[model samples]
Target: MINKYNNSNKDVKYLYKNFLNIGQVGLLDKFDFSEDKIVQAKKCTLYTESGREILDLTSGFGTQNLGYNNDKIISERIAFANNNELPFSRLFFNEDVAKLAKKISSMLPGSLQYSFFSNSGAEANEGALKLAFKYHNGQRKLLIHNKDSFHGKLIATSQITNSPEVYFDFQSSLETDCIDLSNTDLLEEKVLKNKDNIYAIIIEPFSASLARPIDFKTLLKIQEICNREDIVLIFDEVYSGFFRTSNLFYFMNESDLLPDIVTYSKSFGGGISSVSGYTTKEKVFTKAYGSQKDALLHSSTYSNYVEESRVALKALSIFSNTNFQEEINQKRKYFIKKIHEITNLKYVESLTGDGFHWGIGFEKIKLLNLDKLLKLLPLEITKDPRFAEKLYVSSIINELYRKYNILSYAGFNSEIKLFISPPIIISEQEIDHAVESIIKTVEKKPLVLMTSFVQNYLLRFLNKN
Candidate 1:
């Protein structure tokens, strides 16, 4: 096999060059991997080309629930590859796929037994939306999503997602509206107003970007509303599934609060296989694509291949172990407490989150607030309120990687918030190390922190070079 990385700056340049040629350069800029490129990883620690050991907190956006380079997953992949079974057609009956589906069904709540496999979380959500739309006989055209919620980037899914500016080009022309999660009154108002034309209400169950988990009572209320109006409800567990939130799923453990359709991926494949799936009740499946004539209506070419299926089956087994779940809960409490303790720092505004996920927001120092100082001079900086805070968090993240080898990121589109979502397997020692790193990284001198202003200039120079 050809090598993807050569442990050199040339390789990094080639990766960035092609990445900027087609993809969003802003994403690359948000992450400062300029010092070295990662060549291997084990659990929560990343091994870089320059022999630096970096602790991963993002878990590749929460996909590595079991952490990286899992031995069992790797052995399974090798076994599957050695068996010469791959890229097989899903048209034929595959025992491994059926078994995996059955395993997943046993763990899901209520009558969510029927399954549809796909390649990614986006594809699973796309299939879920289609299922909901077809279940209602294409009669309901409107969908509701909570503000700052992320579902996927597919055309229909993107329409229901909260960030219109990011995925607007992929949006559907259909009617869709967003409701604020902070106000249940407004949420209910929107649901009632659009009750007649609504096909579904898709949500992340827990807002990944905001690091907020919806209370069980609120979820029950939403479920009741959807049921009363005959609207399909979808829980997008792409980032929260497979014990990331100290639960197999945030919506699990409650029989009455189950959604009509549940979409999952990310950690479900144990960071080994790119697999995703959607599950619903038999009634909904029958209404949508259960007919013999609609057998192949929503299937994908890579849907239920044997390799991904076997890997998912193993992943489910590992995640469902009771002992593992208990340990994860303990880790969650420790992690959250440590993060909250950091709020005592002068610059930290607040720590908002639950379980193993969190967002650390910073306060602008009055003395060093460049914008405020400029206003004193009868001049002004950018009007964005979070500009200074964003720069501060970005600088902290950069320093965290450079000084302590702990990976972190600014919250999605939010300047002051730093996202912390380490793998479930992360230990107490690692958590303590992360907390110390964050404190030391953020508690820098004002003049030293101001150097983050060079990011724009550095980006422009890199793009030109």
Candidate 2:
């Protein structure tokens, strides 16, 4: 198989189609203006092989919060290459493990003393659940998670994801926690009913994709319930942590409420390293894996990585700087004020989220005879419920990329109308350009954008295929 296209097929597209993933190509195929080969990236800008300079607003889905190729973050990786020294090992006593654990513990709430490292959000979540089960000594039978919560894709975590698309939730495996936070009593009822059997309840404090935060009032109530019921409360801040949403942690903005375990990844690696971790209270850590006998029980081979630790340490320092936060705050206020103005448009139905991430629900404004004209197409593809949404969003995204060279993304799940979450490091000029591009794109008639998109997409598709 390797020999079939080893040297004969040097095309990157061909390599992806044959050896890599065909789905990735299929996903990108829908976006005509997507860069095929990005040659360089620094700060909020991406340089492509086609000599195009794109302003990246998605921040690699919240991984590159410090911006791409950050000088400070990159220097750590460079030092790692130059020195190549092993800072610590998983087997014997590890300095990085101790240092990072202590460092994160100091910044967070006083009780969140111990930490465990992993490779990704899902792994961190899986570890969190394992810790909960171990804390209960495998006596508990249920794990609770919020509806529409995306903890991870690993089988255990997937069971609680509640995603209908890629990560289909095994509804029967895990118990549903709460959805209608407005009902106030809904969470308490479930927690009380399952208190004896529920080991842990996972929650996403701020969902960046949907641009929604679990209400602070509801969170305070959950904290009270968890304290009384002995259920481990886990806050999965994979995509929302590391000042991606203006605050160091979403929960920090309002009042002080700590969870039993907090799983974090994404920007924790400083946009370069792959590191995820869960910090838990000392009691939870000791009760779960206190003894040396169970210490190695729930550990990954890649956990406690020294290079990753070095990167994370540097990233943490960068995040802790007062000047850095001040600059980001100014940009954040500008972005919020600008995005808030979009709600005035009749097309925008709802607005959620805050800081750098926002989800705007758009409703179609019926045209005189555009539907009739669209119905005449070869297939009535517009009949799907999401067709209008996809049309409006995809068109806007494509236009932004093509005309303004700005990159943005749609929210996740079934009802993803629009998600606008740019990198925190984005400049005022870039924000102005990106927001204006979106406004102009949305202002266009859906039919007009669709026609242009189809033609351009076909042109690009034909040029490549």
Candidate 3:
């Protein structure tokens, strides 16, 4: 079968109807926004087909931390590609992999000495789960996850994901028990009840659900409980890893506790489509590597892809350089200060998140209307959901894309949660542009409604009694 790239609006619609049917086209089709609206991106800015400049606020869902078309990264990748490096090779030693492992080990605190690479976050989590089981000799069987937390999309990780939508299709396949992140009492009770059976307690240190910091005290308590129960504490830091959270690692600066296993992806690849790593204590590897057979027990085809490792090494090098963290902190402080100033809108419940990853809660928006709008637009186009809490978020990503060209990901099925995670490399001028765009978008809804009849229809659909 020949693969065709859909460029025109008619082509996209035709392909959507003919080729893609079951796949959810949340934001792409709903808004009726044309591909022409997207300005091909270069560096940090995106240009529309009409030559409108858009300051990217979402950072391609927080993957492009180094920004779009980073010259250094691009050049490095080009050099690697030109050299004809084999990304996948069985039974071979790659120098790039060793270099990346060395670089990662150098940055990590304590004895997180080993690195295992994978293609995506889910694959990394799968490796961690298998390693945890193998380390404990399979005596532990239960995999505990926090409620409403996202880990990955693979079977094992999906089983542990708290989102019902993620598990909606394969509910029967999921076999893990979930506990509410906020409920300390239940957590203790569950751990006690299944102490021997529980192999790992995996958590997203900074939860995307509320875009809030995990309670430090509760986290420490959970750590203690895990120690007492002999359960492996796994921190899934795919979304909050790197220096994106202002801290080098989410668990390092924010909480005193440490996990036995930590999985990282997304930004770790340096905006590339490959690379993921799991850090574990030496003992875990020692136990797993007791024999040669055990060493080959868990491995991926692309476990140590050279190009990805090289990118990861370079990304880490960039992260470790001085001034990166300071710049991130400065930007975060400025953003928070500006966000606090915009309190005129009554729909915003609270703003939460760390470093570059933040969420706006809409406590006062109408959920039904928000759902209708979301149904009509692409998932990235709108942030509001049906929940009263979601409505109060009082922000429209579509307007941001329209006036300022800043694209953000809006939450689904919830009342209100808008994720804003830009690259750490964003300049102050870009930051100012993003903030101004947000301000303009929030204040200029009337104008937006005037331009798009869809917006007017959505408003009327929302206002109907």
Candidate 4:
């Protein structure tokens, strides 16, 4: 067990603090057992250096849909190594690339036949935006996005993102506008008012970041408007695609409406390869990059590599071959029933479910009587009313991991949201364990929770100094 990474002479935590991101260190290095070091992962479980098993509920932020180090997915990597295939040369004639693109196209409904490969979700979305502009020959000057969503951190994608925390303040290259999805009437008016300048509308079918769900009627209205006005509709499914949200693609299961383009990543790589792509209809692709002169205009050096495509092909196979509707339906029902039982717990405020994605809101601080403790905490987090609730939720997240072996985290929801995004491969037994643990954790008085959170931070600070 004394490997190079786990060597006694080398301190990984020190390296992370000095060389890597210190903030990121807390993601794995907290809870009551802060000394425990996770050295191995398999099938939704993380093993510490001392052999402690921690059930992973975050799914590595939804990238591990099939669980960690999945055997079937690793087989693809082994096959490629034995064959000594082209890992990367920017070659245009690889069979796996064509096969992957075709496989992705076939799984989706309608005329989404063309694909532009990339290395991340942001790149794919950026490409989709570019395609929209080219499709209109620069005649369109505006893009519409939702204020409750996030697309990516890249320049163009960041502009479209509306979340206050992550959204940047700089001006955008394109004229961007926002709409409130809750009001369908205002949504229609916004689009009609800017019909001439509008080129595309991008939205997340399911806002996995915050466990937000879209109404079927609103979706249809947007589809109708886009179709009538010849505007492009793009679905940013980076976090919710590839059966992570209980569907092959979230939009397809909800309704028969088809989007002009769909950007995908995260689970598409099967927790192995880092591959992403945006799929669109043949007509859109032809209008944007059909000519031989423009076909390779937007290509990336690392866009279509053999190894990534092979692994992605196997990942897609696992997703497509399995019949998940029955499994998702049964598991979701069991989880919902359990959540309903815990709705009246002492600290539990609101509980909502959407497939495997869920949100558990905590009661505000004023009701919790944490005024004294709130004054003692750092000014940065305590000053904002919005962030105060976040700290309250963080306490629950900490206790959830400290007392129980389960891991949960705060979502990007505007309110005090404790998001539980478990892996799709989770079992009935695992679900029972997680639900029971949550109930026990919430039953504790909020005052006790806040006290523990303060102590945890104090401990971290002392150790750092």
For every candidate, C-alpha RMSD to the true structure in Å: 3.9, 3.8, 5.2, 2.3
Off by over 4 Å in 4: 1-4, 7-10, 23-35, 323-329
For 1-465, candidate 1 gives per-residue lDDT tens digits of 223564576555666668655344434544566545677889999887777889999998878988997888888878888889754864578888888889889988789889988889889998898899899989988877877777777676667666633545663655778777556678778776766788988888777777778877888888888888899989998877887775788788566788999999998888988999998988899988888987777876677767888888888888878897788888888887888878888777778776778888777644454644335321232354555665566677777887788988767443247888899889999999999888887677644665643543366557857
Q: Alpha-carbon error at 457 in model 4, in Å?
A: 2.9
The ten-residue window of minimal lDDT in model 3 covers: 384-393
Can you write out model 2's per-residue Cα lDDT over 1-465, one digit (the tens) per residue? Answer: 012223332276667888999887666776854444676788998876667888887888889889999999998889988997785566677676678888888778758889998899999999998999899998887877777777777777877776544454344444445354435488777666766887887888897656788888888888787788898989988888988785888887765688999889999999999999999999999999999999789987789888898899898888888898899899899988888777776567888887888888877645444575456443555665566567667877888888888888886475665777777988888888877777787777777777787777767767866
lDDT of 4 by residue, 1-465 (tens): 332364431276678878997876664454554566677888888877766688888888878988898999988899899988778776458888889999999999999999988889999999999999989988999998987778888888888777766745776676888787657688678876886778999999788767766876788888888888888999899988876765777788765779999999988888988989999999999998899988887878888767888899999888886465566667767766765777888777787657677888776767347777877766765666675577677778888877788888777545558878787788888888898898888888777887888888778778867
Give the poorly placed runs of model 3, Cα more than 4 Å off: 1-6, 20-23, 32-34, 37-39, 167-174, 366-395, 413-415, 443-465
Mark the regions of model 1 whose C-alpha exceeds 4 Å error after superposition. 1-4, 18-32, 164-171, 253-255, 364-385, 414-416, 445-447, 452-465
Would you estimate the TM-scores of all the predictions? 0.89, 0.91, 0.86, 0.93
Ranking of all candidate structures by their TM-score, best first: 4, 2, 1, 3
Q: Pick the candidate with the highest lDDT.
A: 4
Candidate 2 RMSD to the correct structure: 3.8
User: Using alpha carbons, what is the TM-score of model 4?
Assistant: 0.93
Better of 3 and 4 by lDDT: 4
Q: lDDT per prediction?
A: 0.78, 0.79, 0.70, 0.80
Clash pairs, candidate 2, are none
Query: How well does model 2 score by local distance difference test?
Result: 0.79
If the candidates were sorted by their lDDT against the true structure, best first, what order would they fall in?
A: 4, 2, 1, 3
Q: What's the lDDT for residue 422 in model 3?
A: 80
Best by the TM-score measure: 4
Candidate 3 vs candidate 4: which has greater TM-score? 4
